[model samples]
Target: MTVREIATEAYRESVPVLVLSAVGGLFAGVVLGGWTPETEQVAGLLVLVPALLATRGNVYGSLGGRLGSALHQGLVDPTLSLADERVNAAVAASLANGVLVSMLSAVLAVGLLTALGRPSAPLATLVAIALLAGVVSGLILTVVVVSVVFVGYRRGLNPDTLAGPVVTTTGDVVGVATLLVATRIVLALGGG
Candidate 1:
């Protein structure tokens, strides 16, 4: 293929995905905007938002990339199955990392806020919210990343080109929405 052909192919494959990502981002923003009451009730929750979302994107995005590479190399099949040890391990590792990072982010947020002498919710409350959000979002993102990468690959599209933006956009939307739900659950349980 010539340079023009390569460019055209990349554009053709990536533009629609990018457009979808933009729409997903706008939807995530709408969800966040509607969660003002939760944020207000849980001090320092806003601080956790970026970190949480970024962690999801980074962790799950890497998982997507790895799966893409594996599929390309024929190291794993392009199907979601626990019977495939490689695919199972990749997903397990991503989920563990997601949960650990989520908890760490909450702890760091609380410590930072306390050091700065700013108001923050209790450490336990933040940890609980983080834990809940992390598990739920991690599960959801795992399935999503796997599905998108596999589907794109099967469709003759490059998963490498699809993984990053899709993961980031889905991560943001799912992370924020999960955080809101977790916060509500924790608060109702007499946390924070």
Candidate 2:
């Protein structure tokens, strides 16, 4: 098939997955609520939510897309009973992308917040939280996205059709959960 044909086919297959992702987002939004920080705490760790989640979703979603391509090209096995080199490559790629995306997102978010005159806890605290949260969340997101995509592929579903939406939606949910947990940990340390 031509490039256009492949693109069209991918788009067509994505319709159902898009619907499912939307539903997942709505469900997550309701369950998580605003998660907005109070006026007093607005400048603290609150702003990390969007950044962390966006990074998680983008990186994992991108990886899923690649995995889908690998699947199509017969470069992937369902059991991943591949050689050590291949396994290492997959893990390295996922981690590298995840870390890079997370750091970029965090930096961008911090810059945006600063530009908007938002109060921040401290430069060190902000950086620490952003980097730590990014790394930790990225690792978890890697597992979640890979597992979901692998399972979907095994079931004869197109990863391109399902991975992005599923990964992004789940990333939102997981991201929020991760941020909240991280915030609680920080608060606990601060004797809150």
Candidate 3:
């Protein structure tokens, strides 16, 4: 084959790694943040980072994997260059999945926190707070992932390489920040 063709094939092969790296970075951040030592007063919130990160990764990673399939099947066309109804459907499906996963994560996080003897708030209240934070962060993450993938695709970039890394890293930053902000809000409101 010609050099041009070889270059094209090489670029195509690199897409998947790009996508996975993005998501992996986000997960790594969560794990790192969770494992960080807290001050004596904040020890109870130790699980906040990992739990939130795990949930974010679960929700976003699943969606990313699905999108990867859609891309593989010629179903992803954000620029209207590839007329495929499946792309739109995939976006909708992924959004829904992200929201649902966020809620579930919130519930589990609250339960785990309570079990660990952190009763700053009641279980119900904690769940509500966690769910709200999770959902918000998930929503943001979904939008970011979708937008990044679309832009990358339109620019003739491979989703495999760009999507995963961008989505995962962005999600990690957003997830940690969101958790901290939400926790602070809950504490302030509850006068804890």
Candidate 4:
């Protein structure tokens, strides 16, 4: 593509994602700000935040990559009216990864906190919050990434270019919100 073409396509392809990303950023800031006091009060929860958020991004971002590859290969429909097999498989794998990774991340976070002689939440509480938050956020992000990829493909744009940034941004915002809710629920349940 020529420079002018590239510029035009970039503007066309990226604007929606960028605008949504800005919204996501604002939501993330709110979630962070609101969650900060509790997170500081609980030692292990703060550590879980980064790992939980990263897991959401990694899982959904990879799903986007696979879908983009399939789009390029003429394997995916621009729509999912028939419930595409590849998309189903991708979602299943992503969910499985979300559950497993969230559990592991919680364990790792707790371990690290203990190693550092930091006060820690109960192991079960940390694990529950991480697993619940990660799975919920991952599911939401999967849908968002899939929608972005489908729209990008339908618009004759490369979904690969659009998916990464969008998924990461969505994951960050939704992940934090999900964590906050899960933490509250866990604490209410006497887990914290």
Choose the strongest candidate by lDDT: 1
lDDT of candidate 4 at residue 60, scale 0 to 100: 83
Cα lDDT tens digits, model 2, 1-192, are: 999998887877788778778887887676457555522443645566666777777777888888788878887786656463654576678778766766565566668778888766655555555566666777887777677767888877787778888888878776767666665555556622
Off by over 4 Å in 4: 1-4
Candidate 1 off by > 4 Å: none
**Against the hidden reference, what TM-scores do the models get?**
0.97, 0.76, 0.66, 0.91
Q: Per-residue error at 57 for model 2, in Å?
A: 1.7
Clashing pairs in 1: none
On TM-score, the leading prediction is 1
Query: Cα deviation in Å at residue 98, candidate 3?
Result: 3.4
* Rank list by TM-score: 1, 4, 2, 3
- Estimate, for each residue in 93-127, the C-alpha lDDT of model 1 and write its tens digit: 99999999999999999999999999999999999
Candidate 4 has which clashing residue pairs, if any?
A: none
**Candidate 1 vs candidate 2, TM-score winner:** 1
> What's the lDDT for all of these models?
0.95, 0.69, 0.63, 0.85
Per-residue CA lDDT of model 3 for 47-165, tens digit only, reads 45566666676667666666766766776655644446675566567667665665565566667766786654445454555566677787788777766666766676666566556
RMSD of each: 1.0, 3.8, 5.3, 1.8
